[model samples]
Every structure is written in C-alpha cells, then in structure tokens.
Target chain A: MPDTPKRTVFYVSDGTGITAETLGHSLLAQFPEFDYDEVRAPFIDAPEKASDLVERIERVKRRTGLRPIVFSTLVQPAVVAVLHRAEAHIVDLFGTFLGPLERELGMPSTHAVGRFHGILDNRSYQRRIEAINFALSHDDGIIQDGTLDDANIILIGVSRSGKTPTSLYLAMQYAVKAANYPLIPEDFERKALPAPLKLHRAKLFGLTIAPERLAQIRQERRPNSVYASLENCRKEVEEALALMRREGIPWIDSTTKSIEEIAAVIMQHLQKMQKYADL
Target chain B: MPDTPKRTVFYVSDGTGITAETLGHSLLAQFPEFDYDEVRAPFIDAPEKASDLVERIERVKRRTGLRPIVFSTLVQPAVVAVLHRAEAHIVDLFGTFLGPLERELGMPSTHAVGRFHGILDNRSYQRRIEAINFALSHDDGIIQDGTLDDANIILIGVSRSGKTPTSLYLAMQYAVKAANYPLIPEDFERKALPAPLKLHRAKLFGLTIAPERLAQIRQERRPNSVYASLENCRKEVEEALALMRREGIPWIDSTTKSIEEIAAVIMQHLQKMQKYADL
Candidate 1:
C-alpha cells in the first residue's frame, strides 16, 4: 500500500502561465489516475510580478523537497536569475519556438526583432477573430442573448440546450471572452432583441436545441418540473425558433450535433458573413 | 490592413480548453490577416478578484464589442453569480464534469470541488495536497532556510543543467511536490549536499548533464566565463555525479535525453525503487 507511485506535478509555461496550464490540463485528462495542478505566473503589465514568481518556485521546493521539471516560457534575464537557484529540470518553450518559426520563414531567429510580433498585428480578419474570442468565453446562461455588442456573441437558447457546453468549450480552450444571455420569458413577451442587445443586431447567432432532446436533458436535471415537461419544451422551442426567423436572424439547430459541431457552424457563419461584407 | 484578423485569447482549466484553443489558434494562425491575443487564466482562489477579472474581460469586450472566449474554472456560486453578468463569454469547465461523471457515477452536478479533495485519502498524499496549498499561499520566502521538511525529493545539478525545467515538469504534470536546489560552488567545494540538506539526504535526486550541453546553455547567459566554460561544466557534472555515486546514491544523466525522457526515467526509477524498498 505504501508503495503506491507518487506523482510529480510539473508547470510548463509557453511565455504565459495560463497557456501552459490549459495545455497541461489536457495532458492530465488523458491519464485519469494522474492529477496535475497549475499556478500561473504571467508576465504582463506588472513585469515585477514575475520577481515574486521565484518565491513560488522556492515554496514548492520547500514543501515538497523534490526538484520539479519546468517547461518555462520566460526568456527575460531577471526572471531567469530568480529561477537559477532552484536547479530545476527545464524545457524552454521559447527555445522551441525559434527553431520552428525561423525554419518556416527561412530566416535566422527573429525573436524580439523587426516586423515579427507574429499574428498579433494583422487586421483583416477582425470579425472572425472577435467571434472566436466571444465563443470561448461564456457557455451556460439560462437566458441566451446573441448579439455582438457587449458580447463575444449573445448565446440565446432554452435551458438544457447546448449553449453552456459549447460556449464553455470555446472559452476554456481559446481564452475567448464569451457572454451568453438567455432568451427569457421577459424577452419573448417584449418580442424584441433584449434591450442591451438591440444595438448590435448584426453579430447575433442563435442556438436552437430540438424540443425532444431539450426535454430529455431537462428531465435529467429535474425529474419533475413544469419546466422539464415535453409539452412545455415543445412550445418554447417552436416559439423561439419562429421568433428568430421572423426577426431575420439565423440559428443553428444543436439538437443532434456535438459541441464542436455547433461551434464550428457558428464560426462558419461568422466567417462567411465577414467575407460577404468585405466583398 | 484595418480589416486584419484579430487575436483570440482563451483562459481555461482543462484539456477541453486546450483542444479548443488549438483549433482556434490554428484558425487564426492559418489566417494571418487577423490579429488577436490569447491567454490562459490559472485557477483563481477567491471572489474578491471578480471585478478585476471582469474588467480584463470587459476591456477586450469593449474594444472589439465581440465576445472573447473566457473559459472559467469559476464555479464558486458567488464568483459565478458575478462573472455571469460580465460582458465576455463564460465557457464553464464544470459543465463538462457533469456529463461524464454524472452518467458514470450517477451523481448530481456541483462546482469548485478542489480536485485534491476528490482523489486523496492517505496522510502522505494529504500532506502533499497541503504542500500545494502552502506553495500557493506562501510562494514567497518558502525556499528560505532550506528546511523544506515537507518535501519528498530534492533535485540538484549544475546551472542550466535542466534543473528548473525538470522540477516544474514534475510538479505541474505529476503533482509531485518537487524542490530543486542548484549544486553551486559553495556546496561543491565542500564536496557535499548543502548543510540544510544533510538531514534529508534520502530525498535527494542528482541530475548530471553533459558538460558540453551545460556549457552551451550557460554560454547563452554569461557568454564567456570560467563558470560557464566547458571545463567548469565538465568539472561540476563529473564532481556531482561522482559524489552521488560515492554516497551510494542514484542519479540521472540528462545529457542526450529530452526533458520528457528524463522525467519518464525518473518516474520509473521512483516506482522501481519504491517497489524494491517495499519488498
């Protein structure tokens, strides 16, 4: 019993600690018995915050008496100075970046130099980029609101629908700020875009779940509720989709599709619209 | 140029977030016309920071008026209640935990269950769990006095010999509370582990890098110094590995192997040694 294998928790950062943690989480999920926790030390705005990051390395060293393996994103001298004392096994993510990009461009390491901030500067695909960011943020709102202003996109849909899961899928994976507002009874009665959403009518993308499937999901959440009844769900679905159509809004029927599929459909719609507008 | 593709950022908690980001990154990376920034949000501890987060989301939201994907591990009812009102997309990580675990275990949904609490029962694991908490809270001065009494293992090696990277890799990926200390001139001259480490000698793991690689890595920093010279690196590595051998200690030579290989080797070594001792 005592011989159970103890695990090592690693922190790998690709410059930003958040990216490393997100990627690391994916790696951990592949192996269930393993559990990895991450504490990000980002170097933005207050670069001085990274000075305290060394303290973090030390704290772990003290508490766990074992040297950890680090996949680090930091390349700054001051930060490296702090980490040197820790004597950890490190994988420099920036070190890997140079080779791949340089080779791609047929150039010698352009890191920190001339016209090379990567894709952080191009401005033509702005709308698609915005939609992607919005998609990644908010997932589950009982009231779905799909509009561009004050939203990555307003995700309007009924409860137990695919809105939350899809929105979450986008946000967690992409660092997209997604805000979803529900299409509630109040909105339906008023028969207009929610007041906050009225101004950005163009960015709206509606999510419609099948009435039968919606009932099934709701029943699982609440075995008995007027809210979960199939008859009630049917009426709501019929009304919501009709309203979206009448308002000249387009929506995806997420009934049988997976989360990825729903998101892809939304992305495609956004991309096509952007292209059309450009032309 | 004004219509360039935008950068999309994602703040996430698990593999799902990583997967989504990869797709999103691919899309943006493929279309260089867009400019967007992506970031991961590490696990946050409290609710007081809600507004600060809301502002970060809103800044991006207000500028683009498009939802940026914000994948959240924020399941705290209070935190969720607030973030729910934010202008960004909220991709909820806890939402997925509901689907698989609920179906498999027949359990209802809940949020913010500290992952450590869910997987451990034994005192040693609990101690490590606590160590992570300690590391998180006192990421400052925790390395002082070298009394990492709570540590399970200590890694030591010459500078840039891949110490920090390995330590973080172990900690973030495996959850091993690994603490790495550099084998510096002072300790090397004494031909022994640091004075503070003698008490916990059994928890030591020595890493020996090829003098050539060690020198090459150091050259990136100091450019040219006796300390960063091939001779010094060779001297340090030879001395350290020899010292470990003299003490009947086991060590890993990290010369040719990649970080992944070195970690896998160490994990296997730990497992085998644990088994040997158990028998």
Candidate 2:
C-alpha cells in the first residue's frame, strides 16, 4: 500500500474562526484514515490579511506538492474574493448557506463580520459570566447557603468521576448553573444523600465511571494510596451506582464518554423533566 | 413598518450538534433584525431519531406558517435522507463540504459518526482534563509552589476583569493550561509586579475592563461597597493599565469582548511569540 497522503487544511474566518474550525474538524473526522496538518487563520477581516493567508496557503502547497484545503466562514465579500485566489479547494461555509437563507427569509444577510461570538447582548453575556462564576464557587461540594437553590442542576459522583469539567462545560456553553458534589466514602457508609442535596433531589444527576478507569485516574492524583486502589474504586463505584438507583436519580457512565457527550445527555434529561413538569 | 418575522431553527446532528449549532448561530447573527426560536437535535445517529426530528420540525412549520430552517451535520446517509424529508430549508453541512474534500483528497469518506468531539485518543483527552484541573486549581491567584511554572499562559487583571472564565475557556476549548492572578490594590501601591509573576513575565497577559463596566460587575458581587464604587474601579483600572504598560505586558480591554474573542487574541499573541522565538 502507498503511504498516506498528507494535506494542509486551514480554517479561516473574519472572526475567531472557532465555528469554522469546529465544523471543519467534524467534516474531517469522516476521513479518519487520512493525515492532515491543521492551521487556524482567525481574524482575517481585512483584504490584506486575506492576501497574507493566501500566500501562506500557496507556500504550503508549493512545499508539499499538493493543493491545500481551506474552510472559510468569511462574511466580507472583498476578503472572500481575496481568499478565493489561493491555489486550494475553498469550502465557503457562509456563502453556501446564506443565499438559501436569504431567499427563505426574503431578506439579504447583513454580511457582518464577527457578530456571533461577540458581546452581542449584555444580559446574555452577563448571564454566561455569572454562570461560570457560579460553577467555580460551587465546584467540588463547595456550597454556600442558598447557593444550590439557584443551580439548574447538581451533579453527584465520586471523585475523579468527571464532575468539575462537565459542570464547567454546561455553564460555559449553555449558561446553565451547574454545581457538583463529590460522593465520598462517608456518604457510602451513611447510605444517605448529602444534607444539601436531599432538598434538591429533583435537580440531581449522577455520574459514574468504571472502577478500572477511576483507579487509573486516581493513581495520577495520588499514587499508591487507598484512593487509587482498584478495590476501593470498585467499592465506591458500586455503592454510588446502587445509591443512585435506590434514589431514582438519573445517572450516566462517564468512563468512555467525552465531556460534550456527557453534557448533552444531561441536558436531554433536563429537557425531558421539563416536558413532564409541563404535563 | 412590519413586525419581524418569527421562525424556528433546528440544529441537527448525529453527534453533539455543537458544531452545527455554533455555525448556525453565526449564520443567524447576520439577520439580527429577525426573531428566531432555536432548538438542538443532538445524537440523531439513527434513521428513527431522524424521523422523529422531522416530525418535530414539520409541527413547528405548521404552527408558524413558515418553513423551519435546519442546520445539520448528520453523517449517516440514511439519517440525512430522513432529515431531508422535513418541510424545512436544510443546510446539510456535511454533504456540502465532504464531497469537495473527498474529491480533493481522492478518497472516499468513511462516514463515521461522532468522531470529532469524542475521546478519540486517550492522551489528548487526558491532556484536556488535566488542563481543566490546572485552571481550576490556579484560579483567582490560588497558586502552589512551582505550579505557575507549568502554565501555558498566565492572565493578570483586576477582580472581575474576565480572567477566570477566559482561563477556563482556553483550557476547555484548546487544552491550554491557563493560570490567572488578580492584580490587587497592593500591587498598585507597590508599583511593581508581584514576585511570583516576575519570574514568569514572558507568559503574563493582562485584561482590563472599562471602569464603568468594572463597577457594574463589582456591584453584582458586593453592592454598596468601596470595591463596587465607581471611583475605586476607575483608580484600579488606571493603575492596572499603567503597571501592565510599564511591564511591557500585552493586554486587552475585556469590556466589550467575549471570552472566545479574548482567548483567541491571547492565543494569537502566544503564536506570534513562538514564531519570533523560533527565529
């Protein structure tokens, strides 16, 4: 078999290019067998910047003897025209979708640059910041009086079961106030929910991980301790799972799931509960 | 003058749908005058799920008397086919870009599902989790000995200058170890950088907010206090700006920028420094 061909892929946009890069990565993931060297050309709002990027793409193409791939969300026509001159396969993201949307809405796009990720509305932006602060303050069971009352959801799991990151992601991405509590050995011994959590049972979610994975993660934090022992991990996970089942709180296994997947599952559970509440 | 048209928009995907939703929001931001009710249809990996989503979209269309717009990254051809049956204007993100990418690469895509945001590699996933942990531990100037040395970037600013959220965003989105320190009144009084920060001056980046904005943010935390007073806010911001300028540290005003934009600007600065160091 021939060696895998390598190509340079650029995610270019007038703004931060995060959206372009995210969609570009999703599309590239379909071709897992190929090799790609990815580059981000963000803040290409000016024609001069676009010209510079085109030069960079040309340099890569000449150096590798292969045409590069450019995924662009550029909104400015002049900038897009400049990028079009590159010796590459240009995937114009905004151009492809905007025309259809304009026809459907009976209005032309304003062709604005850097609007989506900017501080567009003060209220929503402040809410996001407040949510982040709430997540941080309430992380790892650091709860103050009446704080848990404001949380949209509270996550309960053993340490290293993927609570903090999930809470932060939910808050940052969706502006949902998430507070996480770690289920310690004491909770398992008592065989009851934490005092604060009992009041917010309706808003509670659980996360469990495989004992082996939990052990592996704990070993990184404290090597050769009982916390990192497989036996201890097994007991904690088993008890946590049993307790969650007994309490009828929803739970998920985070052993093989990414933070994004875990957050999405949690949001679905919240939506379902809201639907039931409306009934 | 007529009232703004209202429409339902669905971001549908086989995976988390975050990429689809993000790009969809960017597209919608162009039409700022219109009103939209947005919904996320994530994890539609099967044709049955796709069919269910189509029903939901059609119901929205029937209620609104307008075709709902769908931005989809559904990879499975069967699921995509089912989604196409909806009475909506579909923006098939994958279909539009994948064909061109395949032709450029001279290979067919595997059409796999949920690969981009999943834990594809254990090492990279671990790195991201570790970065999040680092950001949390080093947040708000809570630093241990030798901890700041591992940071990829160190953010310094007055309280509520957008350090913590930006640090968390950088860690979550880019797997970057970001440590943040608050520049306090003492630092201003001393007219010198903090001792811990002086050792790592090269990694330091500053964030400043407009005094009025800072006062507003502080009022939310500590109402009717000296810290929340506009006079104090003005003095602190002025001193922080002066100190950063004197120290030759790069800084940006966070008054109007989102976390994504702030993180993107910092990353650009880091990249430029790396390029210069290479020379």
- Residue A55 of model 1: what lDDT? 61
Q: Score the docking of each candidate (DockQ).
A: 0.02, 0.60
lDDT of 1 at A30: 32
Measured against the true structure, the TM-scores of the candidates, in listed sequence, are 0.36, 0.95
Best by lDDT: 2
Off by over 4 Å in 2: A1-6, A119-121, A275-279, B1-5, B119-121, B275-279
| lDDT of candidate 2 at residue A98, scale 0 to 100 | 93
In terms of lDDT, model 1 sits at 0.53
Q: Which regions of candidate 1 deviate over 4 angstroms?
A: A1-5, A12-16, A37-69, A77-89, A106-154, A159-204, A210-224, A238-250, A253-265, A275-279, B1-279
RMSD values, in order shown: 21.2, 2.9
lDDT of each: 0.53, 0.88
Question: How well is each residue in A163-223 modelled by candidate 1, as lDDT tens digits?
Answer: 6545644443222345665676666778777776676567667888878888887887679
Report the Cα lDDT for residue B75, model 2. Answer: 87
